[model samples]
Structure formats: C-alpha cells, structure tokens
Target: MGLSPKSKRRLQRILPFGVIWFVIGLFVLFIQEAATGNKNINPNVVITLTPKVFVFAMISVTIIGLLVGAVEILWLGKLFNNKTFYKKIFYKLSFYTFFLVLTIIIVYPFAASIELGLSPLNELVLNKLSNFLISLDFLSTLGSIAVSLFVSLFYSEISYNVGDSVLMNFFTGKYHKPIQEKRIFLFCDMKSSTTIAEQLGHIEYFKLLKAYYSDFTNAIINHSGAVYQYVGDEIIISWKFEEGIKNNNWINCFLAMKQDLHKKANWYKNNFGLEPTFKSGFHVGEVTTGEIGTLKKEIIFTGDVLNTTARIQGLCNSHNVDILISEELIKELKPDNSLEVKSKGIAELKGKEQKMELFTVSRSS
Candidate 1:
C-alpha cells in the first residue's frame, strides 16, 4: 500500500536510527568477541544471523511499532491536539515507553544470542531469564534504554522538522518561487456537514471526516492533483493544466473523485443512518500557486479562480446538482455526447467583475 507523505517521512526518519542501532549492536558484539581473546570477528555474520530468525524479529518489531505509533499518532495525539503542554509530555512518555519495550523485546535477545553464540535450549532460556531480571538492576540497561528512546524520538522530531523545512524551502524560497504561478482550482464541500457533525458528535464526526478525507484525497493525489487546504467541510485542490485546457487526466481525476464520494455515501448510509453527499465545482483560470504567509507559511493557491470554484460549488445547493464545471473548463475538455450538460447561463461571480458561463454535467446522454 502507498503511504502518505507524512507516513513516508516518519519511516525515513526512523530508518536511520534503526540502522544505527543495528550497527551499534554489532559493534558491541565485536568488542565482546575481542575481549574473549578471539582472533577475528565472525566473517559470516549475515549467515550467522539466520534468515528465519531475522525475519521473525523484523515482523515482531514492525507489528509492535505500528501498534505503538498508532496509539501515539491517533489516540493520544487526538486527545490533546489543543493542549500543548500535556501533548508534549504525553508524546515524550509514550515514545520512551514504546522504545524501551520494543528494544527489550527485539534487540536484547539478538544481543544475547550473539554474545553467547548458540547454546542448548534450556541453557539459553535460563540465561535469558536471568539476564532479563538482572539487567533491570543494571545502569547499562537503564542508560541504553534512555539513549535509544531519546534517539528514536529525536529522529522522529527531526524528520518532521526537516520535511517541513524542505517543503517550505522548495515552495517558498527564492530559487523556485518563480515557478509558482497561477492555475485552475477546484473545491469540493460536503453538503450538510454540520448536520452530520451534530448527529455523530465530535469524536465520531472526526472519525468519519478522517475516513472521508483520506479516501477523497487519495483519489486526488492519484490524479496528479495537490490538495492545498481543507476547511471544516471542504477541501481545496488544484491541478496545473497547460494553456487552461482539460486533458484526459483531468477528466479521469474528476471521475475518480466522484466515485470515491459515491463509495463514502454508501458507507455513511450503511454505518450511521446518514447519507453523505458533496458538491464540487471546477474552474479554469490563472491563480498563483506557492507557499504563502510569513509566521506560518502554507502551501496554497490564491486568486479569483479559487473563490469562483467555491462560489460555483455553493450554487450546487440551489441548483440541485452534484457537479458543476465552468464554461472555461468545458472549452478545454470539449464536451462529448456521452455526457449531458445544461447551461445555467452567464452570471457574475462574487469576486469576479465579468459574468462566467457555468454548466452542470449529468449521466443522462
């Protein structure tokens, strides 16, 4: 499965630390072997680390890591999104605990096996249990656990900071700022979002919204669209079209988005006695695209095109239509006979001076 940018960044962040720990574990094993007056380190270390054993260890670590990360990212993070002090402490404590448990479970055994080599099952078990209890009293255990936890949490924070910095530099910095030009914008808003929120309550409503957002945004990204912003009930996405013309990719993008929404509608109806629906509008025009704002710079699109798209989407509520495409967009797509379009005539938009033509597309041919 494809991971989100955030997930990918987290993995990238954790990987170096994992590798470093693996190396340090190997180094300690080397030192222990040398201290025994051994002539050389194990040449076939990779072979000595049995594939089955390593695979089992990796799988265990992955499962545990996922569980811990989920608890940290989803549960605890959500509980205190607004409370900075408590959230920081909770995250630190959770990170330390997770790292300690995971290291003890996954790393300690490997270290013991390397240090002692292969031994009888009974001896191995006795040695491990004895060491486990004794190690609890050793300062080395506490120090190593503290170091590992600190490293892991530090890596995670660094990754987030670095990724944000990179994105900001690329989008907002002087080098690439010139490429951040205007483009077509689209915004889709869920109808009766407040009603759903009221019915579901805050927690349940957030869960539903998360699912909806993930599904819809996945579709958008698949179509080479960038989701810039998500308001309370709406998402603003933009795609750069050459010469303001809609291509096959853009059409496929809309189709995928609509299909995603349709699936969510079915899910909402089945699960919550609520049918989820949304109205979307697309506009083709010039709009600046780049990272904006000084204190909290954000990647965004700005101009009349964005506002017009929102306005057109709002019109869907009154027009009784689910999708609306602007005339400028239609010119780029070349409306085919397979789809039916009804002209709503020209009307001046909220922020625009000139009247723009709008049309609603339906399945009826």
Candidate 2:
C-alpha cells in the first residue's frame, strides 16, 4: 500500500535532522581546517582534514543525526510523553549522552585504524584512541553535539505543541494580516458527551476523552486534515478546499475514524464499560483566517460556515444520523460507490433565517 500522509509527514520530520547535521559538519570542518589550520597532535595518525576526510565526516555525522532523530521520534518521544517538561528533557539528555559515548567507543577505534592504516586491534591505534578520548577535542565535539541536541529537542517540542503548519505560518508571517481563503471544516462532537461524563464522572470521562481524541490522530493525519480546535469533546478539523475535495479525503477521513473506533470497541468496553461514538458535520466556504490576540495569540477562522457546520452537527440526533453535510459541500464530493448519501430535505436550522438542505452520509457495506 502507498504511504499514508502521516507516514510521509513523520519521514519529513526525521530527514531534516540529517541534512542539518551534514551542513554543521561542513561548517565545523571548514573552521578547523581552512580557517584555523588545525592539525592532529598525534604523529601516529596520518589522515589530515582533507576534502575526502571532510566528506567522510559529513556523511558520518549525517548518519548519526538520522539515527538520533529516529530514536527521539519513535522511542524516546513515546517513552517520555506523559513526563513533565524538565523531567523529559533531563531523561532524554541522559540517554542521548550515553548513546553518544557508546557511539564514540565503537566508531572511534575503526576510524582511527583507517587513518593509521592498521587493524583496529593494533596496540598503536588503541593507544591513540585512548589519548583522543581523554583529549580536549573529544570534549569539544561532545559539547557541540549537546548544544545541537538541546536546540533540536526544543524545536521539536514547540512544533509538536503548536503544529508544523501553524509554526511555519507564524515564522513566515503568512497569516499575520487577515486573509480570505476558501476552506473545508469538519466539526466532530462526541455523542451524548454530557451523559457519558455523568456516568463516568469527571476524571474518568476526561481519560476517555483523551483516548477518544488520541484515536482520531491517525485518521486525521492520514487524510491530511489539520485539527483547528479542541473544545471539550468536540474537535474541529480544517482542510484546504482542493485538498478536502480531492479523492474525497474529507468523508474518507470520517469513515476511517469510524472504522478505527469500531475496531477498538472491545478495548473501550473493557476499560470504560462503554464505547464512545462521534457525529460530524462538514461544510466548505470562504473564511477570514489570521493571527489574533495580544496576551495569548492564535490563528482563528471566522465565518458563517463554522456556525452552519455546528448547526448541521447539532441536527445529527434530530435526524437519527451520525454524519451531516451541507448541500454545497455535497455537490463537491465526487460520486463514490463506497459511500451512501441521502438528502434530509430543506429545513429551518435553529437561530438561522435561511433554510438549508442537509444530507446524511453512511458507509455502503
């Protein structure tokens, strides 16, 4: 199968570190060789910082960066997910420090042997490695690595919290001034959330909400949906107009989420004594998008579409359906055999003067 958007995004996040380290390696090499005219103190070692040596160093450091980034994302991130900020930093630094030390122990011997044109087991090479490990050069390299690690980790944390696109927009000032853009929105709300909270109590219900929201991550990312907001039990996801319409990603995303939740029904039942379900309303329209606020800043969308979407979602129970879409958005969806859509006819939506034609959507078995 082809890679999902989520997988592609993960790879995108991981690869940049290697490229960055490759550049850093080049800069460091230039400073040491061309700028400072530094030379190796050990007479046994013959390899100087030539272009070939620089290339080797760049490739090696890039490989190290790839390995470190992969570990941070796949292993350490999940391991320290629930940890406090400072605690997570401390633990990650500790583990990576040890990892770097171990890497030096294994790689330095081979590297030194190559330079000396001798076996890694040679006494002369071993003696040089011993001196190098204790020398100021090793300490300096370690210090540089430490600084890079801290900065990268900080960037990753901020990116994760604010979202990649949002952070980029902030840096690029794309949304600094309010701009009009057509976008698609999916307003998804939990079914009978208040009743569930009452039954489970506040704390347990909070846990369920957490799990519920977490389960939607794969489906959202896989479909290229950006979560706009998390208002209690409801999550609003947004997509570019073309993105949502292409391959019917907007509807497919909802179906994927439904499938995922159903697949985990047993687990939910075992843990929470019940399984949670959600209803969503889809609408597409032009909205004013911009960065707003003084004390606490945020990128917000303001338009009638949002209100209409929420109203559509509110009608879910009245219609005894789990999904609803505006007539205009329905026209945008390509005809597909996998989905069955039925018109609910024109109706006066609450607090709105204009009548709207709505539709209920379901997966065709």
Candidate 3:
C-alpha cells in the first residue's frame, strides 16, 4: 500500500535524522567554501577543489554507513521486535550509549591509529596513553550519540506498534496489489475479557489489554507470524504457505503465546489483581490480500478462511478447549511426540451452512 498511517508516521520520525545530518553537512560545506575560497563570486578568484576533500568525505560516509547499518540491522532489529525488551529501557539506553562511543572510536580514532601507527595495533607513540585519548574527538562522538538516540527511540516505538517486518512490508508495498495466496490463519482471543474489564475498570483494563497483546506480539514475531488485525481482544495472525507449514510455526505460535502469557500471570495478578487467559483456533486456506482504504489504509485479507478461523476460536468456550484447528490444517501438520491432537468432530460454524470437521491440539503435561 501507499504509505499507510503507521508507515507515514514512522517515516516522519526517521526523516529528521536525515534532515539533521543534511543540514549539518551543508553548514560544513558552506564554512569550507568561505575558508578555502572554493567558489568565489568574483570570476577572477576561482579556487580549484582538491582530491583530499573528496577522499575525506568518502571515508567518513563509508565508515558511518558501515558502523550504523551494522548495529541497526543486526542488534536494533532484534531488540525492537521483542516486546519484553521495552520494559528494560535502561539496558536499551546503555547499549545505545556504548555503541555510539564504540562505533565512533573504531570509525575514527582507532582507524586513524592504524593508518598513523600511533597505538597498540601499530608502533607505540611517545606519551601513548595521552596521545590516544587526545586523538579521540569527543565532540563528534556526542553528535553521533544525539542522532543515534533520536533514530533508535523512534524506531523502537514504531517497531513496538507495527513490527520490524511489517514496517518493511509497509514501505515496500508488498501487499499493495490484490493476489490470492494460500496461508495459515490463527485467531486468538482473550478469555473472560468482559469480567476482566469490569473488574479492572476502563483505564486500568486497557493497560491489561496492552500487556496481554504485547506478549502475543513477541510470540507472533518469534514464530514469524504476521499480525493481520486486532479485533477487540482478538488477534488475527497469519503466515505464508511455506513459512506457516515448515517447522509448524503456525501450531507453535499459539502454544508459545500461551506460555508467554502464563509466565506473566503473576505480574498481571499482582498489578491488576487478575490473571489473563486466551484461546486460539487455526486454519489454512486461500485468501485475497490487498491494501484497503485511504485515510487510514491497512493491508488486509478478505476470504471465508478468516471467518472460519474466527468461528473456530469461538467454539473454544463451548468445547472447553484452549486451541482448536480445522481438520484441513491438521492434515498438513505433523504433531511431535509430546503434542497430541483429538478429534472434536464436525462443527457447524456461524453463518456457514456446511459442518466443518475440527480438532483440538494440546501438549502432554
């Protein structure tokens, strides 16, 4: 799709990082021009540019790109995707600070040492400790920290809201055009949501919902499941045919999600005086995928599969089952020795005339 709301907001935040650097570069360029007379308005005083300037700029750009891109893609990507990591903002800030200093040290001071033979990697220089510390430009390191912090903070928030892959797919417009793709769908909903809401009240209840979904987000990302939508307390998760089927990610996602929440049960109970519980249903089928809407555009799926998955999850309460899967999906899944599947028989889902065969999936205690 063409710049969904979330994508636009994130881009807007990231754009400042680029703009700040561009403006600083321009300011430096102007200062260099005034100092060197590289572009005198008077025709008689035309100063030629030297290769040294080009060499310096190229080195700086290359060093900055390598250092920043390496950390961003490898470290930040993982940190942002893990919802639990946000709870540890101190660690995040510490890493950012350390990375900023380390990157600048390697990119400039340490690199300069290698070329100049002024440090340990080369020949030791006179007053080695003093010279090495003096060689480091604290001003430039601070600048790097300022820019990195802004970018990292913005990215962390966006990744929390959408996700790393979702942010990328949003910008790439991967689902902009409509196409039918076979996929696995898992509809997971909070159990006893009404009672929880009433007990916690509206404002505090929202916090509980947030914490519950955060756990779901972590599990979903861990299993490579893309979040299709969040309806009320229900989270709709999907995966491509290959991704969902291989390694049984579709199956594990629900189980893992349960475990993630269960681990947080005490926190919920202490904070909100209640433990959170949820149920899920899974199915696989073809769905029409496309970007829909304008003011608040979203990548969405439209097909009977989505409805069927929802209905299947609804059966969880009646059947007293935590997870249910359509028989169609079960055929493709090979249950491990510890995992077990029990036939729930045919279920005449809501708004559907056909009675669909269903099965309950569980793990051995």
Candidate lDDT (C-alpha), each: 0.61, 0.85, 0.70
Q: Report the C-alpha lDDT of model 1 over 215-288, residue by residue, as the tens digit.
A: 77556655656666779878877666762343344555666777777877767787777767778888877766
TM-score of each prediction: 0.55, 0.89, 0.68
Candidate 2 or 1, higher lDDT:
2
Give the clash count for each candidate.
2, 0, 0
Which run of 10 residues does model 3 get worst, by summed lDDT? 40-49
Query: Model 3: what TM-score?
Result: 0.68
lDDT of 3 by residue, 1-365 (tens): 36533344445444534444444444555665787567535221121234553355445644453444445445664665555545545555666677666654454434444434456344342233234345433554365455545555655456556755666567778888888899999888888998888888999988888888878866676676888787888888889989888778888888889888999889988999988888889889999988888897777788999889989999998989889999899999866887888998889999999898999878877
Runs in model 1 deviating more than 4 A are: 1-180, 243-247, 264-266, 334-340, 362-365
Model 1 RMSD in angstroms: 8.1
Order of the predicted models by lDDT, top scorer first: 2, 3, 1
Write the candidate numbers in order of decreasing TM-score: 2, 3, 1
lDDT at 209, model 2: 93
Summarize candidate 2's per-residue lDDT along 1-365 as a digit string, tens digits. 77878887788677766866677766766666664457754454323664555566677888988888899887888899998888888899999999988887777776666666789899988887777777777887788778767766776677778887887788789999999999999999999899999999999999999999999999998899999999999999999998888789999999999999999999999999999999999989999999999998899999999998999999998888899899999999898998888999896788899998999888887
